[model samples]
Target: MKFYKANNMKPTVAALFLLSLLGCIEACAISLNAQKKYPYVLLGNDYGILNENDLGGFSWGFKRHPFNPKDSGGNYWQCFPREAIEITLKDTGSSADDIAWNDNIADLKIVVWVNQHLVHEYGMRKRLSIIDFERRFNKWREIMKKEKYVCLAGDFVNYEHKNENGIDMDIYEWLFEKIKTKKSCDSYLYSCHPTYEAYLREKSKEASYKFRGISHG
Candidate 1:
C-alpha cells in the first residue's frame, strides 16, 4: 500500500471531527433516556404505614424524626420513586403499644402504596424493623434526588421554597419562578423564552401532565 503523507491531516483536526461525532451520539442517548422517564409519583414513607396499633410518630420538617437516639431505627435512609415504599415501625415494647393486655406484637406489617394503590405489602418480624427502615429510607432519597420531585416543602400553592438538603437549590428556585409567572399569565402555559415554549409545545399532554406531578414532588 502507498503511504499517505501523515502531516497532510493534522492530528488536532482529526480529533475535533471525532469529538463532534461523539458529542452528537451522547446527546441522542440522553434524549432517548429522557423520553423513557415518564411522569410518575416518587411515593415514599418515613415509617408511615397503618397497623392495628396507632400509626404513631410525627414528621415536622427538618425537625429530628422522633425515634430515640439509642434506637437505630431513628437514623434511616431509603430509596424511593420505586412505584412505592412502605415501612412498618412495629411496636417492640417501646412506647408504641399498650402492653397490659398481651398486646405485644405477634407480627408487624408494611404496605407500600403507589398513586394511592397498594403495590407492595408484607408482614415482617419485629426484629427486622431497624434494618428495613434504613434500607427503605436510603432507597427513596436516592431516587427522589435523581428525579428532583422529592422537593421537601410544605405542600402549599406557592412551592417556590424547598428543603435545604437539595443539591440544585438555585435551579429549583429558577424553575419555581418561571412556573409561577406562567400561572399568573395563564393557567394554560407560558414561557419566558420562545425556545422553552417551543420545546414545551413538542411535549404531549401526557408528558406535560407528568411534569406537573414532578413539580409537586
Candidate 2:
C-alpha cells in the first residue's frame, strides 16, 4: 500500500501511520480462517456501509454483525467523542431527563485504544484548556512510543467547526493541529478527514471526485 504525506507533515509521522495499516493487515491474517463465515472484522460502531471505490480500494471488512467489546477479549475499547458529551449536555433545562443527561456527561470518561491496546483514559470533567489538551496529548504520545502499530477508530466529527446543534467542535481542530505539529520518530498520529473525497483531494492535486463517501473515522 502507498502512503501519502502532507507537505507540512513530517516523514517519520507519516511512516508511523503506516503501522496502523500493518495492524489491520495482521488482524485480517489472524481471521483468515474465518473469512468465509465473517468477511469483515468490524472495527468501530456501525455508521453505514462504506463504498470500496471511495476508499482507494481499501476494504475494512463488513459490518454485518454488531460489535461487542466483550467478545474482543481486550482487543476492543470504547471511545466517547467530545461531541457526544456536548450533545448530551445541551439540555440545560431542569427537567428530570435533562438532569440525568447532564449528570452522565459530568462523569464521562473516554478510553483511547491504539493497535487494539488500551492506551489512555481521559475524563470529560477535566478543564478543556489548551494546557490540559497538550498534557493529555503528550501522555498519549509517551504511551504509544513503545507500540509498533497504531490504529485509532472513532466518529471524529471533522465536517465543521460547529455541528448543526451549535455545539463547538474546536476540540477536534485543536487535536488535529497538535498531531500535525508534533515531531516524533517513534510515535504515530492519524487525522481523519470529513469525507473520503476531501481526503483524496488533500492527498493529491490530481485526485478526481467520482463519488461522495462517508468521512474517515
Candidate 3:
C-alpha cells in the first residue's frame, strides 16, 4: 500500500540501518549452530557428565571434537573458565585411579595432562597395560616436545587465541597482557585495603553487581 524510497531516508538514519545490519551479520558469523560444519572444542565436564566418568587430568583449553553434531552429543559447544578447571582437578581423580576412571578420555583421544602439561601419546594409546602405557608415553615424550601453548577443553584462557589452528595467536597474547595489567592493578588495590573481602562484599550489594549475573554454559 505504501512504499518508501531509500533516497527519502535521512543520511544518519540510512547509515544507522547499514551499521545495524553489519552488526547482525558479524554476530551471526561468530555463533555455530547444530548443522554448521566447523572445528570446535567439547567441554570435558559435559563429556564426563554424559558418560558417567571423572574428568581425570583434563584442564581447560582447545580440543578436537567430532565435527558431526550427532557424534558430539549435541550441536551445542560449551567453554568453561580456567577457574572451573582448578576445582575439577582437585575434585576429580588425580592419582592412579584417574587412569582407569574415564574410558572416554582415552577412547576419545582427548589429551591427558601430566604434571600440568599435555602428554600427547597418552591420548593416542589404546589397549595397553598401565606399565606399557607409561613406557610408550616415555618414548612418545622423547619423540615429541611439549608445545609452548597447549589449549584443551576446559581451559578458559586460550580459547580466543587465533592461529593456523583456528586461533589468532598474536591477538590472544595481547589479551593476556591486558589481563596481566588488570591483575597488577588489583594487586595494588589489595595491598592498599586490609579488608579487601569486606570491600568486595559491600560492593557486591551494589546495583552493578545485581546487573551482572553468573553466565551459564
Candidate 4:
C-alpha cells in the first residue's frame, strides 16, 4: 500500500523473457503465477470471508498478500480500479461485532478507499455507490506507486438520499473501463497480504482498512 512513492512496480516482460533464456523456468513460472493468481480480496469487516479463499478460484475473501517486504525487487504497485471490489459479511464476522450490530445500526455498509482515503459508502437499501471515477483517474494515473481499492455490494441498490439506483454508470466506467486501459502511472494492485512489509509499516497511517464503519469488532 505504498502511496505517493516513486518506485515502479511494473515487471518488464522482456526481463521475464531473459530469465527464461537464463534457465530460470521454475522461478519465472512462480513469479508469473503470483501475477496471475492473487490481486484483490472480497472481504467485509469479517474474517470468515477470507477463510473462504480455499474454494478453488474463489479464494479472495478477506485474504491478504505480501508483495515486496525486503524490496528485493524495489518497485511500485498501483491498483487501477481494475474491478469493483465486492464483499459480503456472511451474517456474522468481526466487522459485524465491531460496529455493534443492532437493528439501529443503520446497516453500516462497505467502503471504497484510494490511498487510504474514504471515497464512498453503501447501505442495505442502497448497498452500493460508485465513486467519482474521473477524479480518481486523474489523481491516480500519475501515482506510479499507489494502490487503489474499489468495493462493491452484491446486494441491490438502495440509498436514503434517493441518489442511488444500483450501478452508477459513471462509477462503472471508473472501475471497469480504466482497468482495460493501462494506467499511465506505475502502479500494481497486489493481494491483501503484500510482500512489502516495511513499506506497509512506514505507510501504516496511510493504509486504509476499507472496512471502517463495520461493527465486526
Candidate 5:
C-alpha cells in the first residue's frame, strides 16, 4: 500500500515540475521578445519606454523658456545614416509626428539634419521625399562626407514659470500656435539627470516588478 502511494506521488510531482519549467520558458521568451521589439530602452525617472533607435526620435534634451527653446530645438536636428534613413523612409517608418510626440501639447518646427550644414525640413507629405533627398545628398557629398546621425531641432515648446509682480505664471502653447526662438542657439545632447533617473527607478520598482530598473548599487 505504501509503495502504491509513492508511485502515484512521483507522477504528480513530475507533472508539477514540468509545468513550472514551461512557465519559466514562456517568461523568458516574452522578455526576449520585448527586448527585440524595443532595441533601445530609455529608462526614465518615473517610467521606462522602448524605442527603435536612439539618434533623434523624441528627446527631452534641450530645455528653454516655453517660448524661446523652439527655435534652438528646431534649428538643429540629426538622424541615422543615409542608408538607415533610406530604409526608414522606404518602410514608411519615419513620421514628423515621431520627431515630437507631444505635439498635441504644443507647437514645434524641426529640421532633419545630416550634419551641422546638410539639412531638410521634415514633413509628412504623401509623396516620397527619399529620392529628392538622395539627389541633393549626392550633390552635397561632393562637397563633404556623409554623416551617421539623424537629428532634429527647432522651436519646441517648453513650459516655464515666470515671475510677475512676485506672482508665478505658467506659460504654455498649443501646436497650432508658433513657438518663439531664442536670440542664440541653445541645443544640447540628450541627457538624463541623475536625480530624475533615480526617481524613475524608484517609481518603476513601485509600479511593477516586470520593469528593468537602473541598479544604483
Candidate 6:
C-alpha cells in the first residue's frame, strides 16, 4: 500500500492523447478475450466517474459493460469489463469497505483517489463528524493492509485552525502525520517551477492556435 500527496502538475496534452490511444488499443485487445479478468479497481470521489460521452464506446473497452448504479446513499458503483470497479463516494453514508470486502474483488488491486471533501470541508459546513471521520480513517488503514490498496492521489487540507474554525483541522493534520510514518507511504510538496511554466506556455500556444482556427472557419 502506498499514498501520494496531491500536486498541481498536469500531464501534457501529447501525453494525455497518447494515453487515450493506448487505452483504446488495450480495450480492443481485451474485448477479444472470452474469459475476462479484471485486475484494477479505481476508487475516488465524483471526479472519478466517467460518463459515456467522456470516452465514447471505448469507455470500458468492452462490448458489454457492467451495471453502474447509485445506492440509496448516493454512491456510485460502476463495474466495467474484466470486472474492473470504479466507485464514486458522494455522501458520508457511503463506505468503500463494503465494495472492497466483496468476494468478487478479492485478491485484486485497488487504486484510490481521494479529495479534500472526504476528510475536510470548507466554510461552516460539516459532512462527517469527528468520531465518524476517525472511524473511516481507521477502516481505510485496515483496508490498506488487507487489500494492498494504493492511494495514488489525495489532499488532506493541511492548515492551522482554531477551536472556532468549525472544521476538524487537527484530524487532517493527524492523518497526514500518520501516513508520513508509514514506510509504504510517501508525501511530497510541489512548488511552481520553470518546467511547469514552460508547459503552460506551450498549452497557451495550442489553445491560441485552436481558437484562431475556429474563428477563421
Give Cα distance to truth, residue 205, candidate 4, Å.
44
- Residue by residue across 86-137, what tens digits does model 4's lDDT show? 2222222223335444322222232333222123232232211122222343
Residues 2-88 of candidate 6: C-alpha lDDT, one tens digit per residue: 222332223332443343233333333223121123211112211222322212211133342331212111111111111111222
Q: Which candidate leads in TM-score? A: 2
Q: Give the clash total for candidate 5.
A: 24
> Candidate 2, residues 188-212: lDDT per residue as tens digits?
2323223456556655653333232
Q: For candidate 5, what is the lDDT?
A: 0.28
Which digits, one per residue and each the tens of the lDDT, describe model 1 over residues 1-217?
Answer: 1111111212232342243233323322223232223101111221221111111111211233322212222211111232233334444544323534323333233333322211223333233333444454344334333241121111112112223555212100101111111012111122323243344455566688899999998
Computed on alpha carbons, the lDDT of every model, listed in order, comes to 0.26, 0.28, 0.24, 0.27, 0.28, 0.28
Off by over 4 Å in 5: 1-76, 79-82, 87-121, 124-137, 140-146, 150-217
TM-score of 6: 0.22
Cα-lDDT of candidate 3: 0.24
lDDT of 6: 0.28
TM-score of model number 4: 0.19
8-110 in candidate 3: lDDT tens per residue? Answer: 2122323423432333233222333311223332222121111111111111122434423123221222312222111010111123454664322211122
* Per-prediction TM-score: 0.18, 0.24, 0.18, 0.19, 0.17, 0.22
RMSD of 1: 23.7
- Can you write out model 5's per-residue Cα lDDT over 1-217, one digit (the tens) per residue? 0000001111232342343233223322224443334322211110111122221223223221222323423322222233322211232334445544322222122222222222234332123334443443343333223433322222333434467677544432212111111111122332212234554666577767544344532
Name the runs in model 4 displaced over 4 angstroms: 1-31, 37-105, 113-217
